[model samples]
Target: MEFVITGDGSNTLYHPEIGEHYHSKHGALQESRHVFLDMGLHHFLAKEETNEVSVLEVGFGTGLNFLLTADDATRRSLQLHYCGIEAYPLPTDVIFATGYHRFVQPATWAAFMQNYAQALTTEVDFAEHIRLKIAHEKLMDFQTDDQFDVLYFDAFAAIHQPEMWSDQSLAHICSYLKPGGIFVTYAITGNLKRSMKALGFTVEKAPGAPGKREMLRATKVG
Candidate 1:
């Protein structure tokens, strides 16, 4: 795994074996804030009546998404139960090398790193509003009866990890969402949109984060 700086000055890991970056080369922070934070979490919070929100993230590569969501949840005063599934967790060295902590307030970063140290071992309460549970397991093998109000599908591109973007896999993941739950991702492929539709999601093509044309947001319509 190589740490490479993205266009937005944020770092992302490049897996040479898979030939995929953990985030958009355009901007890791930009992509996460746009697709996951803005489109997924905020969108869910806006429409949902509950003070607490449940979120499941497909790829927890560098914990960027979780950290960003935790920050937002704290600021919004919304309780967030965040579950992140990652088959291969990055080493602490790689995570530190990314310099993600430099981007946030010192207090927030400190809390994030403290929880991150025990991320794979147990659920960590980064803040009163943010409780994170990291599962070191493949998404396909993950089992949970808890349903989510938001799903951040930040997996590698369908081309690199086709199984992750397959109709069967998407359908399976969608089963974990509550009705009217929001789903967001950086991938905006035609086949993916169709697959979401076939699975009963009302899909929308949202403006991409950067260095891309568009992204996708879908809602489970029941």
Candidate 2:
């Protein structure tokens, strides 16, 4: 993996094996804030009246989404519980080297850096209102009774990891979302919209981040 400075002056890792960057080259921080935090979490929070929110993130490569969401929740005094599923978790050093700390609150960055490894083994309350757990397993093997209010589908592009975007995979993942839940991703395609509709989500086309034309912001339909 090589560190590349994005157009927005943020750092994102380029994976030689996958032939993909962990985040958008247009901007790492911008993409996370636009697609996940703003479109996914914030939209849900505004529509639903709740003191606590549950978020499930796929990929979970650099934990940028989680950090931003946690920081946002802390400021609002909202309780947030997040779960990230990663088939191959990054090393502690790689995470520390991402230079992502410059974007999040210092306290949040410190807590995440200190408890990241522990979160891989078990859920940890790293801050007064933030709890995180990283499932060190493939997405299919993940089992949880908890149905999330927001789902950040941050997997690699379907071109590189087709199986992760297959109809069956989409169904299995969406099954974990409660009715009226939010599901957001940085990519939008005809196949994706069809799959989300078939799986009972009211999908919409949202404005994309800097590099793309559009994104998918879907709400689970009963």
Candidate 3:
């Protein structure tokens, strides 16, 4: 594992053999805000109204997505089951060193960060509305027996991690999505769109979040 500081002192991580990359570039806090909160949660809220929502995230780096999702669940008083997969997880020091609280509010940041740490290292409910479970394995190793209402496919860009966006993974993901379930992602590569289409998804190009022109959201057709 190698780490580099982005232009703004945010951390970016790379795993050479595993073909994984994470940007703490905006910090994990900012990345989650832009990628998951702004892109995933915003889109989810606009389309659905449910007492409970299931979310599956592809890359569980920094636990930022989980924190944000848990916070939303608490705010909306909605039940949330967040399932994520990560082959390699960073240590707590690496996570804390990124200075997530600097971007997020200080009060909630401590509680959120504590939950985030406990969620990664243990499998238990940290609160009433939110449950976190990490597969602690490659995404490909996980079976698609359980379907989710939404999937946050915030993997590294297709260019940076091609295998993670392959047809096989898309197929696996589709099998885990209910009909009409939505999958949101930050990458807008043409090959990725084709792969999702091949896996029986009705793909759409959605408005991108910050630092990008467009993102992808594919729906499973009933």
Best by lDDT: 2
* Consecutive 10-residue window with the lowest summed lDDT within model 2: 168-177
- What lDDT is reached at residue 84 by model 3? 86
List model 1 lDDT by residue over 9-37, tens digit each: 98988999999999888898998898898
Off-target runs (Cα >4 Å) in candidate 1 are: none
lDDT of 2 by residue, 1-222 (tens): 989999999999999999999999999999999999989999999999898999999999988889999999988899998999999999999999999889888999999989999999999998988889999999889988889999999999999999999998888888999999999999999999999998888989999999998999999988
Write out the backbone clash pairs for model 3.
24-27
Per-model TM-score on C-alpha atoms? 0.95, 0.98, 0.83
Better of 2 and 3 by lDDT: 2
Which digits, one per residue and each the tens of the lDDT, describe model 3 over residues 184-220? 8877888988888887788888776546677788877
Looking at model 3, residue 102 earns an lDDT score of 55
- By summed lDDT, the worst window of 10 consecutive residues in model 1 runs over 102-111
lDDT of each: 0.87, 0.93, 0.73
Per-residue error for 127 in candidate 2, Å, reads 1.0
Query: Which sequence of candidate numbers ranks them by lDDT, best first?
Result: 2, 1, 3
